[model samples]
Target: MKSKNSLIPLIFSLIFFHSAEAICKPRGFDYIQPSSNASTSTSQQQQSPSPSAPAPNQVPSSPPSTSTPISNANSNPPSSEPQPPSSSSSSPAKTFTPSPAPPPTSSSRPLAGINLFNQPTPKTEPTTVDPAVKKICDSTDYPTLCLASLTPFLIVGKTDPVSILELAIKASTQQAKLALEAATKLASAPNLPPRKASGLSDCQYMFNDALDNLESAMDAIPSKDYGTVNSMLSAVITDSETCEDGFTGQSPLAEFDDKLRMMGSNCLAISSLISPII
Candidate 1:
């Protein structure tokens, strides 16, 4: 009885609020309801995907991104399609065969290089002084002396008795002149006895005679006068002997005198071999 009017106004306000709230709310088309008042509610809300985020099952319209391959120097590349090897890789490299060198000829020889074979040097043969040296020396009185002295003077193959005799006389003449010089020096001594001084003087004169005879024989030998050369060389030996006899006991010129006679004997012997060169 006291508040009937206030209750009436409160009931009007609640009805107005429910109507206005329903009109102002945005409608969700995603969900469908069988009745307006009886709406179906779930524990989780199912969200529709945006344009930026794709679903797991959906395929991309554009191509997938490709990854770049890493290169390694030591690693071998994998072969594709089980391919057969090309001719360049599978075949052997070409072999180089050098041409054989030409044989060495007399006209053209290879240049000298290192002596790999260690070849020995060629040996030279020994040679005699002359072809007729042994034959001529074997027939002389002093064969060793005659060969030794005449071998240096003779031609290789020539043999003439006159020429041999001339060489002999020349050798003998040299020895005789040496003796003469010795005798001449001895004879000029200041305090020499009359006997030794006279003997030395005689030796000098005899040696001079022997040398003159030998020189004459050499001149006569070129003309093939073997008879004159033989006589002259024989006188040369006699002159040397006479010089030796002038001294009594152990003469100072005994060695020279003996050598001169021996040389004179060789000249005499060689002159006898001359056959007049007809």
Candidate 2:
């Protein structure tokens, strides 16, 4: 019995030594634990129902039980930072220009004076009178005697108004005297009536008066005595009218009235130059 007990203790000692050797063996990990307590704690944490595998909301406090410790890894340099493209400002808008205006044109024609309507004018020329008759008839002397001789007798029995005949005779006698006086003053040839025969003497005398009045009127014109000239002409016209009336009906009255016609003819002749008197 003593030997068997001793052998049983020795066997127990050998089993214990082998087990210690296996538990204490080194691994590839750099870290090593002094006792099994850290391993046991990890194993118990992993196997103790693992807190029902912790819901997604559960928190864990312990560090990881890794076979090797964690180490930081080298990182690649950051890619060159791309700069945002710079925004450019807009340029100013363009300006515009305008064109000039044109001027007005002028007319070719100028304004001037011109008579559009053309017409005719009469010829201005002097007319001739019998100088001998004009010289004697224009006088103013013996006006009453010369006026008495002329008569109108266009009708066979008609007689002129004695008063009108007297006025004509008075005017002619004075004209006759004036003519003789004018002739003497001008030193011109005297135009006197020749003494007539019988019943024709008064007619000749009146004719002589007509001649002197006309001459006297012409002479008066140079003296600017237009009134005297005009008066003489008026007297002569009156005398002729009286002669035409008084001799209209008498025999030889034609010859008597002819003297008055001569007086009017003389006035018309002078009127050519004296026409402006009208």
Candidate 3:
């Protein structure tokens, strides 16, 4: 009976040993742990739970809990590192910068060629007659009459000898025409004396000759032939005097005598003015 009891205890010890071994040993498909040296294994065996304790599946679940803290640590580091780059980029965008305006070009200004410093000046012309012409007119026999007669031409700024001679010829022609008309009217008048009628006829012939001489002088003036012009003008003066002489000592005839004397004197003065210029 004691031997049987001893056998029972031995069986119990074997069974217990087998259960502990099964619990401690790693299964083929289970997670592999780091290999431990003999001393570390002996310490781990002493701290291990008995075989009757719960299965170690709960311990394996603890590794995922530990990995949660590791994931959080990695996530935090990335967030902190990227924050500076984001802040720097945002700060640059917030600052304002404007583009500069364009400079003034040549096309913008209108008066590019106009000069402000130098201005244009106005032109002026002469407005008065020369003094030398007045001196020549002063030397005439009828100085005041000659100057007054030539005033219109002188104001035009031309007082040459030919112009004076032309003016004198025109005056003489007008006087001769007046005298010829008077003589013709007198000669045709009824109840006139024979001497008075003869004198009027003679006056008409002399005035006709005076007009012809003045015309010849005018034609010679353009050719600048002073000698021929002077001779013809002298003949005009003589004809005027002769017409007046025919009426002199015959009758009153004051009007005809005054006209003939003026015409002769004007012709003589014009011929004298022509002498020096030629």
Give the lDDT of residue 260 in candidate 2. 45
What 10-residue stretch in candidate 2 is worst by lDDT? 113-122
**Evaluated with lDDT, which candidate comes out highest?**
1
Clashing residue pairs in candidate 3 are none
Provide TM-scores for the models: 0.51, 0.24, 0.46
TM-score ranking of the models: 1, 3, 2
Query: Which 10-residue window of candidate 3 scores lowest in summed lDDT?
Result: 116-125
Per-residue alpha-carbon lDDT of candidate 3 for residues 1-278, written as tens digits (9 for 90 to 100): 99999999999999998898778776684534446656665455446575344345423213322334346644634454444465445445465688798876745754433332222221221234356555655565555454544444443545566676687667657656766776776789899888788888887898798789888888988887768777876776677666667654753344554555554576566667666766
Segments in model 3 whose C-alpha atoms lie over 4 Å from true places: 1-134, 148-155, 248-254
- Model 1: worst 10 consecutive residues (lDDT sum): 39-48
For residues 1-278, write the lDDT of model 2, one tens digit per residue: 99999999999999998789768666764434446667855655555556646435445555445576445567555569886556685656878766665543323322121111111111231243233322322432322222223222122332222222223334344434433333233233255323212223444445466666667766665565656666776666665444345332452434334334444433333332243443
Q: What is the lDDT of residue 175 in candidate 3?
A: 56
Cα-lDDT of candidate 1: 0.69
TM-score of 3: 0.46
Give Cα-based local distance difference scores for all models. Answer: 0.69, 0.43, 0.62
Stretches of candidate 1 above 4 Å error? Answer: 1-131, 155-158, 276-278
Models, CA RMSD each = 22.5, 38.2, 28.8
Superpose all Cα atoms of candidate 2 onto the true structure and report the RMSD in Å to 1 decimal.
38.2
Top-down lDDT ranking = 1, 3, 2
